[model samples]
Target: MTTIDKHKPILVTGGTGYLASWIIKQLLDEGLSVHTTVRQKKHKTKYQHLLDAAKQSPGKLKIFEADLLIDHSFQEAMTGCELVTHTASPFKITGIKNADKELVQPALQGTRNVLFSANDSDSVKRIVLTSSIVAMVGDTIDIQNLNHGVMTEKSWNTTSSVNHQPYPYSKTLAEKEAWRIASEQNRWDLVVINPGFILGPSLSKRTDSTSISLMRQLLSGKFKMGVPDGDQAVVDVRDVAKAHILAGLTASANGRHLAAAHQKDFLAIAEVIRKKHPRYPLPEKVLPKWLFKFVGPLMGFSRKYVERNIGYDFVFDNSYIQQDLGLKFRPFETTIEDHFKQLVNDGLIPDKRS
Candidate 1:
């Protein structure tokens, strides 16, 4: 691993996101100057926590306005930074009306915008990209096709497209685009963190992402009846953030890293939440897979998605991240509990456990 120049500011795009927030926090905590980009600089309330963190920590923080879809918008923030971390991308799973415009374009073009900006910058030496495990396997059933039932860094999501699992499709294209751009240049190298479903406390109070939305449903009794039967590869938000830092600064950090910690079903997650708030009627069992296959369409998932995803086992190989980054995962129990309590502390989840 090479040394990090603390004097050089590291750029982290999409500073307001669930994962990006933690990334920014760790960067600041390490006393490194951080240059972060938001869609708009006027939304002070949206990023006030970051300013607060900067004030309290030893690191200097500067916020710049950037639009992911806008060409060269990230150039100002990325200029003169030796390390650039791209964590900005739209992550909506449901309510997508136009897949190409809403998901694919932004995810793909955003990477284009950032990596191009990196190319324009002379000081850049390394870049860390935030990618999802979905980009490795389109759906859980796709896992069955893997040689050893484990997803490695070599896995590429070939099953997603504009019509099916478009979110994963977007991520797949975006990461590929990053690597493709990196290959054309030798000045800067690329490192990718392919994390599974990230959980744990979010620094911001936003519930925009699917992960936060799922946690809300689990705690707010939306899934009190039951969640669809499925197993998901899961990881802590903090661990993912640390992986980004490691990848950005470590000279030896090359290629993609599968950064998930464990694989667990929905019932196991609910059981963790229910240990303290059992009266909230958290899911005690999985909703029958056969039933969800029919109900999935109404919930916005395609019938094929339900058929392929529901009731499928989740198995992952996260050794790449563990071995290269020397990153350790937080306990699954801590991940669930800390996330649940954050929602409660922020009043996003009410005291309806009675």
Candidate 2:
């Protein structure tokens, strides 16, 4: 593996995303120039925050227009960069009219486009991919069949399909395609960071992210009575961003690393919020599994998903990331509190009691 030049700018795909924005901020803070790709250059409002951040740091920021499905769109931005971080992917959980067109194809083809550009770029030597834990296990119940009942980097999701759990299926296919492409070439090494449900203050005020939406739902009394007893491996957005930078810079970081910090259910997350803001109507009770199975459809959850995930614990072995990257994660309580405070401060969530 070739050592990446700190002086040269690095390429970060989907720079306006919640996770990508944090990664860009850290890169600029470190005095490293960044080349970021956006879907439209005309939408200056989307990436103005990145530019503002660059003004405060020694690093410079450049924005380029790129599309995930369009071949060679990322080539110009990737030129002269020794490392590339691919964080762009469709992440919608519901209202997906066409899973193949919306989630699966874009994710799979986006990976292809980015890696293809990396292959064409002579300066590129390593790639840090933003994969998710869904690629490791489709549902929480899948963990029960494992030897230790915990997911690791070696685990691969096999239960998800285009029809059911389409988001997880998309991630699984995308990461698998990335690894397959990386194996065919020797010029650049591939490093994948599989983070769990990411939550933290977003760099932008955008509420389009699922994390922000979920937090809003919690604070808005949508689940004041109770929430489904389903566990999700969780990680802070900042930690996931740091993992990408470390994965790109560290020579030994070649394989997949799980970046999750804690394993907690929806109700546990609500409890964390309630502890900080007692005024908010955060759910304290865990809804029964059978109740979830009955009402999950109203909330856009499939029967198969509810059957396989509700009441099951989602655990992961995150020791590899800590041992390999020397990463110290912030406590889950802090993450949840900070996230809730950000939303309230930004006026994104209603502070008044129902």
Candidate 3:
């Protein structure tokens, strides 16, 4: 493992994100100075928690303004930093008017802009990017084509595009672009952490990302009618953040690491939550696939998509992350329990069990 010099500031893009905030916190705990990038410096309220963390930690925290669409915006942040953690990729499943403009361009171009600056910086040794399981396999049905029914780091997403699986496609292209840029020059090594459906408490109250927003829906009684039958790979936000830090400092770590715990469907989550807080409007049953096929389109899901995916089994070979990075995963049940507690603590849901 490469020894991290505490004096050198590590750059963390999208520092305000749920996962990135945890990464910043862990680095601070290690007495490593952190340089974080956000779009606005004027938003002090958004970063005050970081200041709180810094005060209690041995590390120093510095924030700089940077935009993904703007060229060279991250240059100042990347300058003089020995390590970079790029977790700023856009993730939105709905309300996107232009998928290419909003999702594709920012993700691919952001990697270029950040890596270009990192290459120019003399101190940088490695970069850790926050990728998603979406980049590993498009849907649960992808297991059928796999040799061992496990989605590993060796796999690449083959079922995404602007027209379909747009979010996954953006991640795949962005990671590929990062590799392409890294190969063109040997200045820095790249490590990608591909987590699946990250859950647990979010530092910020914002519900922009799909995971946090899904939590909002659960607490808001949106799924009280019936939970979707679709399954997903799950991971904790804290674990994902820790993997990023481990990947950065671990010298032997390279390529992609799948950071997921297990495969579970929406009904599984509802069952857990329902058991914890019976008074909450948690769904008691799974919606039928036929219903999903007929009504899913009205809810914005494509009919073809509903027919092909959902209500299936898929596996993620997270063994490489534990073996290569020497990291351990928290149980999936613990993630759900902690996530529910956070929702209640944040007032997103009331303490019904009490």
Candidate 4:
């Protein structure tokens, strides 16, 4: 069992990020002091939401500037922290002109840098890593070969490479590096929260998050024509945040815990949104696999990706998270409904019907 100090301020990297923001809020709501990192210290506009949240909570919030690739950049922020949640990593599926430079190096180096700092810090006892289900399975087709046709913590993505599915490749490599570093030391225990396609509201209005961008595309009529028949394990952002807190504080929590709530297709997600808000131009049908395969290249997806992922169903075993962390996921309808409502309220997505 690992010992954690509730009074000592906990450190959370990437505080302004979509998932990290919610994690910070949860920690503050519990009246726990939070120390978080951002890329720029002077960019208050980017992180003002966090400051505002801090004002409303009883817990104190301290902001620090740290870079993912810089060695020991996190040491100052981690000085008195017993628990560290590393959530900073690059996540992009497309517009990759150079995969090794854009995705892999940052992720691998960032993990190394953070773990190295954790090793240097005598106060740190537990580290909760924010990993993705993509690290378990590279593509939906890979699920067909699994023993029970479901992905679990035992799975490792073997098909992803720098040339194909670079985002997943980066996550897989980063997580492996974290494990390798953690195994060499006994001072701190490492717990990993591997969430599925995280979808929900954001604390910031920034449209850069992959989740936010995807949600915007869906509600903005980008998929009004049709969506591919692809299935993915979905989880709410709030539940994922709660999982991190549980992993960090729970003495018995260990190893990789998958945090997916449901497995559904794009059309199913749209249906949920359409049910709540029928005015949006949401896609009502799934595009034929062959049609997507032919036109996918034009939309930045490689032929191999379409071949391996389209028209396939991917599922994840979330029993470990529920059993270990005692997590109860929100309904998919609630996640989708809340997410669209937030976007509309924030004016991130103007009502096209208007």
Clashes (N, CA, C under 3 Å) per candidate: 0, 0, 0, 0
Q: Which candidate is the best by lDDT?
A: 4
* Candidate 3 lDDT, 66-122, residue by residue in tens: 999888899899878888999998988766678899999999999888988888788
Q: Which sequence of candidate numbers ranks them by lDDT, best first?
A: 4, 2, 1, 3
User: How do the residues 325-349 of candidate 4 rate in per-residue lDDT, one tens digit apiece?
Assistant: 9999999999988888889889999
lDDT string for model 2 (262-329, tens) is: 88888878888766568887888988878888888889998888899888887888999998888889
Q: On residues 108-171, what C-alpha lDDT tens digit does candidate 1 reach at each position?
A: 9999999998888888888899998989999889888997877889889999999999999999
Q: Tell how far residue 314 is off in model 1, in angstroms.
A: 2.2
In order, candidate lDDTs are 0.88, 0.91, 0.84, 0.93
Worst 10 residues of 2 by lDDT: 345-354
TM-scores across all candidates?
0.97, 0.97, 0.96, 0.98
lDDT value, candidate 1, whole model: 0.88
Q: Which runs of model 1 end up more than 4 angstroms from their true locations?
A: 1-3, 352-354
Stretches > 4 Å off in candidate 4: 352-354
Candidate 1 C-alpha RMSD relative to the actual structure: 1.2
